[model samples]
Target: MNLTPADTEVTGKPASRAKRPAKSAPGAATSAANAAPTTTPPVTSSPLATPTLTAGVASVTHLTEKLAEYMSPSDLKKVKEAYRFSDEMHLGQVRKSGEPYISHPIAVAEICSDWKLDAQAIMAALLHDVMEDQDVKKDELIERFGAPVAHLVDGLSKLEKIEFQSQIEAQAENFRKMLLAMASDVRVILIKLADRLHNMRTLDVMAPAKKRRIASETMEVYVPIAHRLGLNNIYRELQDLSFAHLYPLRYHVLAKAVKAARGNRREVVKKILEAVKNTLAMAEIDAEVYGREKTLYGIYKKMRSKHLTFSQVLDVYGFRVVVDSFPNCYVALGTLHSLYKPMPGKFKDYIAIRKLNGYQSLHTTLIGPYGTPVEFQIRTQEMHRTAESGVAAHWLYKTGDTNMSDLQQRTHSWLQSLLDIQQQTGDSAEFLEHVKVDLYPDSVYVFTPKSKIISLPRGATPIDFAYAIHTGIGDHTVSVTINGEAAQLRSELRNGDIVEIVTDPASRPSPSWLSFVRTGKARSAIRHHLRTINLPESIVLGRQLLTQALAAAHLEPDLPETLIERLLNESSAKSLDELYADIGIGKRMAALVARHIYGLMGGESAAMPVDHANAAELDPVTICGSEGVSVQLAQCCLPIPGDQIIGQLRRDQGLLVHTLDCTVAKRQKQKEPDRWIPVKWGSDINRRFDSRIKLLINNEKGILARVAAEIGESDANIVFVGMDEDAEHVLHQLRFTIQVKDRVHLAGLLRNVRRVAGVNRVLRERS
Candidate 1:
């Protein structure tokens, strides 16, 4: 398997660009230049300095020097110790590029140093691969570098053996574990990110399929995470590199497009930068101004998503202005607008309203020289540092060597938030799903009644906002008032909208909210509440299921606890507690549990019901049996009490009950006869069942309203309704999930459905 990096992209042309009047700011061309760092320490030539260091014996002296700019001697010593340990452990191993494996760790540490990470993070980076690739141990690491650094390194290690059913599942699980570990300590994530970046840089050595898989995962998982953490520099580079590997043709095309745009925008960029530089100088603002080009991935993403040609994708160029102070950032913004025509409605002040990751900047798009559109971001030196280094910048920017309580609080809040999400969500797939959604870069900023601004992911409705504000507000949300107007509680929020949530004591989370809510926290909280509320009922159902299963096996319901415990021990369960917990969580099949419990209680081949009166009735109305298949018709397909039916013995799956006339049954019988079983509807069955009906109504605005009314009149719940269309008809598939005592009740409901206006076909689905 291979792992690569991913990139990011800008979405749209400036909305206000369409309303701009052409204007050109006259100025000399600015030099094609890169900005210099505000403070630079002297560099020392390395022994292996062919430019970069050599393998195995390469000194981390440069990394140490860089660290010294950000850390103390004690911390520096700790980092050196870690580097030395990694070097010894990787003494003989080598990378595909023929560099010693120790060089890889040194390189990873160097990347982290570029982020200006704290001593612990850098130390962890230097030792990240030791446990994974060598015989070195975590205990050894702890002894050398202390518990925290060792713990961070251990957290960053990939599982040694992944016994997943498929490669995708294995990779996904590995990513899940990585994210979970990262949630506990942000440093683990930083080290992992550095590791991934280095791996991506070496991905060309891997095979093509592996390259694509790794690159896709990087795009889908890691890059979004980096973006969420405000590590946009890494985020963007990862995206670009991954795209280059995963879609080289597209990457080159987009790169050329951006390069060509840069060449064409040369005069515009030069004039814009000169005008801004001169304006800032006149305003006596000490600032650094640099031009920024959109990454190739950004251009490709815009072209692919918007179905636009390369030239049609605007906003491909921008500039970054870094000032010495927060006040000077606004001054620079003012200077920029004065020098160029400001595009109306194309300004955002992120400094006043910071992002979830604490990113702060003033963003604007202007009609620059030659009427070309350009985006500009203005920020202070500190904001620039944070923008590049993200959480790592906190270590360097603190004054007087003060404690990191405030920084720790903010970082810990973000970390603990992930753990909270994990606790509420049991399914790894669902947890990852929520994390992906939460990591989307598009954001919507809203305000509370007290005027405190909060940002949430775009498309986030008020329910998400409620949870973001406080869990109590989310759990008890009854209604909401958006900007003084009563609004539906699920209303989508907009930028700068003031929202007030209304709660009721009796209000509780609904499963339906999962369909509309967007944030991970809100989704997890709602699901957790629902899970808790349903647990007692589920446990009761489980008990009934267990008791009925025991009766089927000719065993007593209340067998001795000692016998059950002995049976569980014989099974794989370490103790009864594990068995019961599994049963409670639906992980252990109730039927299986009952069978094991009954077998331990003297069940025999001869069947008998200990309590004949309490034996569950084999109701013909609910339980359909065909050819010993014991096919209970799926309520979804609804083979009625008298309906002819067939059973599909699904592979590693439950028998699927279907009517004899069901097309699905016919297809399955044709393909796999040995898997098929006969089924019949039980005579005494009395449970309510659901079957779908279709209506071909003329496509009209209110056709859905009439059909819904008819279903309501029939006393049926509209469990689901889906609409498909053709030129000839608006095909509506309506699933009336209703209670039916028997075949007669179903027939009557079908007849009633047939009478509804525009109802075309009310036939039951074939088994």
Candidate 2:
């Protein structure tokens, strides 16, 4: 955002536009990508002069006077109408700082004007809060200002009328709404950013908690967005402001340090700036050179992350060299490099490969006049504008400017991705999570086999790369070859590594992939696919469990559909599918659900309320570890067919299956007995269960063969094998996971193994 109308509220969108996020797929040509848009804070105070207008007050007052540079006469008149309408709607309202609420909108409008936004955007900024704070209708605005302007205001308004489960859900929902609007007409985001900038600047009057919360949110979400949008000036100010609000002491201390550094190094900075200018002038390069200080927040981040003190954070000063044309940018860089040695590996040609945010510059750290490192950013004036304003630069430079095309495309692609992620993850919270993952500022630019630059977060892996290319490839990936070398699926991608994901139709995404995948999209896609693939099987299992529980409640199979609906409603589930899915996943005890349904049906003693808090009274479910996301087969117990089993509901992890005699289960039961659910083997246990046993075998050549043959003879396959080696021992200690029917089959296998020619003794292992 830009400078405030007074000093109270800072306004103006960043001058730069983030790179247009384009689809990066193998065989697709190069491009750039990246953030979101906001809300009305409590009425705020600012030093700007307010237009005094009373209710029913007619004004031949202001129109285009402030925006004369950007607005036409006709558009200015219409903007006046919008201002009049909005002012009246918020007539008696006052902000937290005791400012007339009307003054707030005008201040926001001023910020938009500074961005050189169109009259429609300026007018929308004036009325953005009216719809939410007052009873103004969308249709009424359309009638007065035309659909385009109405739409912009509507996009900026928070959906306060809609109920949200949490504050975060509400915030995310608002962003979703705003992004959708901004995607269609980028002006909406510009106006929203202006509003945020104004509010943040005048945030001094708010309560400590609210101030901290807003400031933290601004730092985490908005500041980066400003950076991504290339609103460097606003981005920097917002970052400093948010830092000041969130950590007042740190902000003041850091501010002083930067100030002191500037004073101490003023001579060095002046020397560097003059020397660079002289060199460029010597080379006959037309450029403007000036010294620039790094933002306070950036310096603080470096200090904290790199464990550096104030004085140790070198490169705190830099120079911006803005040239008239693109070619002169290169010429200026050459001239500067000739004057001072460029720091090895401290050079980047963003001009050749723009940042994901569409930032283009020739960045090089140099040995400056004082022998201390100084950063130099060389770019054309146009690039400089986009670098500062980011997405907002699109309006400043115009759509037809070739420099803005990459940014526009990147913005469009990123917006489309938000829509796609929203569609993929129906829940606002989850979508926000995915949004957070993609919002990480640091990204590694990797190349696909076909040389397409696929960008991912710094710690992204092959799975993230594969998914970034296509979900199908990530899901079915069988192998990966990075830079002509075969690598693990979890290999971290490095900058410039050529990654080729080898996928197979026969392969499937493993549950383990959830642990290593770094990208939110990949995580969501995997989770969604797992949910999609598992829900049907889960539902089937859930239905079977319910049927058994209903029978226990003395209910018949031909029960009325109305009763099922009632049960679903009682469970607070949207559908029977959801209800079953819940039960299948182990969220609700089948027996407990049955009891509730029975009580609803007025069964004998059903008149008595069921106390689910004492769920231990409920009959346990039949053990089948197939319930997706709900039930997990305990790795410790490794219960197979015929094992005495029990189920326990663990928070967030679903239902866990354990052997009745498992020491882990016993310990848990002793600690939280209410969680224990009775479980037994099902009638048709068709699936294989892995049962492990330890054996003491004579160290004979054919002992391994004998043990394997004996297990095969018992009709149980050896799923795994391990041996504990001891040089002094003549007997080999072996462990095996064998598939079996149940305890009965496992007991039979144990006997068969004990009778093996070289096997001396065998015992069942305890979990």
What is candidate 2's lDDT per residue for 1-767, written digit by digit as tens?
A: 11111112222112231222232341222111001112222122211211222322222233245677667888887777676666556554555555555666776787677667787788888888767656578898889888988888888776767765456666777776776676677787677767777777767776777677777777776766666567776677777778888888997888777777778988887777777778888888888888877777788899999999998988888788899999888888778888899999999999987888889999998887758998889899889878867787675323344654778877766666666666666465566677777776788899987899987888999999998888788889999999999999988888899999888998877656767888877877876665566677657656766776666556664557888777666555788887776666555666677777777677753453445454345455666545445467777888776677887865323467888888888988899775566777667767777878999887879888888988999999888999985698788899988888777888888888898887888998767
Where does candidate 2 stray beyond 4 Å? 1-63, 164-168, 327-331, 395-404, 505-509, 540-574, 582-614, 625-767
TM-score each candidate. 0.70, 0.76
Query: What C-alpha RMSD separates each model from the true structure?
Result: 13.4, 10.6
- Highest lDDT model number: 2
Write model 1 residue lDDT over 558-601, tens digit each, in one string. Answer: 76778866776665566554444445444456556665565566
lDDT of 2: 0.71
lDDT of each: 0.66, 0.71
Query: What TM-score does candidate 1 get on C-alpha atoms?
Result: 0.70
How far does residue 582 in candidate 1 sit from its true spot (Å)?
A: 7.0
lDDT of 1 at 557: 72
lDDT score of model 1?
A: 0.66
